[model samples]
Target: MADIDLDNMTLDELKKLQKSVNKAVDGYQDKQRKEALAAADAAAREKGFTLSELTGGQVKKTKAVSPPKYRHPENPEQTWTGRGRQPDWMKDALENGQSKEEFLIV
Candidate 1:
């Protein structure tokens, strides 16, 4: 690595250098992770097992989305899935004696 005279560099020059350094570091880290994973996969295959199987083949879990069960009377775009706490609009309407059944999407 070459010596950098950081104090002499202008702000723009420092920013450009910083960006270049960040890109280089990220690329190096990604390459290292890929190489490590490849080595682990090869080792697992040699032991007559796949990497996924040894790792339990687990995948990232995503929250299940409930379909919208209620919609605003005037604004068709505004909707609620009827799972969590009611929206302010719903609360206000209910306070004004509007029934929840009136807001049902069906």
Candidate 2:
């Protein structure tokens, strides 16, 4: 709150003032963040769920990927789960007049 003339300050004084300002700002932000988190946790608890569950803040557990359902006709080693993008071999097969039903595992 002190109105000191910054122009009259030495280089070291200005640097010290900058550090103090930065430290104060960091401390203020940390306090605010903590308060916000506490409020969120309280609100979540009131709604019968933890803050992590309410806001999805917890690390998600990955589900096991399903086994491949379809296989290549030419090469039995090549297979697909029919989930994501098609493989190059599958694309080539399709291009060469091969029906997708021909590659079914069952």
Candidate 3:
């Protein structure tokens, strides 16, 4: 590319140059983005999934909620999934000389 003598250019010429430069930059960035997306799609396809699925761009199918495994002894309304941290009610029961096994729904 030839050297652009901005010092010798008129105000109108400089404005045109700026516009052309901005357009070229935008086009280059758009091309790169498209190429990246294509690569990601190809990789996802190789893994038996789509780019949308990997990126969560499509509506996600939610998993079914698991049934409660443990129920509160005193309050039958309270229940625990038995996956994460113990519930406050169960903790209180244990602290008050109650066994966790006693609260088992079985």
Candidate 4:
């Protein structure tokens, strides 16, 4: 590979280079994942069991979405399921002496 003088590159040239690098990285990662999956599948077949049978068929478990329990006072579109960390709006409201019940969806 030829040495590239990144310090001397114009903004457009740098941006183009960055785009190319990102594309190349994505392609490399995809190829690696495919190769790994193929190897796992082959190994499973050799063992007389499919990969999905040993791994519960899911690459990742999906969490069931909880229904929103709280809504923003000013914006009905903004809501929280009353799980995880409190959102900034909820925090600010609580700091200003607003109770959690005030934001209840019901």
Candidate 5:
């Protein structure tokens, strides 16, 4: 491979380079996810249940409601998937002598 002289590269060449880099990064992320899933499946087998048997449609049927949208910390005008949202009430409770990990089943 020849040296990529960025100063001499055209706009099209720069776009191609950017696309290639994004593709390589996405490939790495996909490989990591595949390895993690394989490990989970193997662990399930060691526990005397195959991945399919352990799942058995049980994992897919959650009845939880969708969480509310949250204002982004960096950009207040923007919103996020509340998977990482810390509501003000929850934060206050934790600050005032409460533990977030203390959920009780009815």
Candidate 6:
């Protein structure tokens, strides 16, 4: 990635670089798919079909997503929620080396 110093490259060079790499390709594909799905949903709504109705009884139930727990980068302290009162145990754990990824997985 160090070879990709964009600031030093010419427009022609930049175009060449982009062509050779994915360059946010995954995000772009996801965005396009989302847009297409949104358009389909809107069309269905206009046709007086409820979102559930259009799914032909194949809708998947989804729960509200809970926020990820936060832990200190270098410590073991873990926080189930990043909001509200901070706990002393969490602070101590964070100081000990329990990272955010470890907290999330646990």
Model 6 Cα lDDT, one tens digit per residue, 1-106: 3665789989999898787666578779879978877787788899998666988967555677666476544564544576677677666667888654555534
**Per-residue error (Å), model 2, residue 52:** 0.5
Query: lDDT (CA) for every model shown?
Result: 0.91, 0.87, 0.87, 0.93, 0.68, 0.70
Off by over 4 Å in 5: 1-8, 56-106
- Number of the predicted model whose lDDT against the real structure is largest: 4
Q: Give the worst 10-residue stretch by lDDT in candidate 4.
A: 54-63
Give the poorly placed runs of model 1, Cα more than 4 Å off.
59-106
TM-scores for every predicted model: 0.54, 0.53, 0.53, 0.54, 0.43, 0.42
Residues 1-106, candidate 5: write the lDDT tens digits: 7787999989999999999989999999989978987898899989998777777845333387764454434445553334676766556656889765432111
Model 3 residue runs over 4 Å out of place are 58-106
> Candidate 2, residue 65: CA error in Å?
35
Q: List the residue pairs that clash in candidate 1.
A: none
Q: What tens-digit string does per-residue lDDT give for candidate 2 at 1-106? A: 7798999999999999999999999999989988988897888889899877865777344599999888987789989998899999889989999988888888
Residue pairs with colliding backbones in model 3 are: none
Please state every model's RMSD to the true fold in angstroms: 6.9, 12.9, 15.7, 6.1, 11.2, 10.0
lDDT for model 2 comes to 0.87
Query: Which parts of model 4 are misplaced by more than 4 Å?
Result: 59-106
**Cα shift from native, residue 62, model 4 (Å):** 16
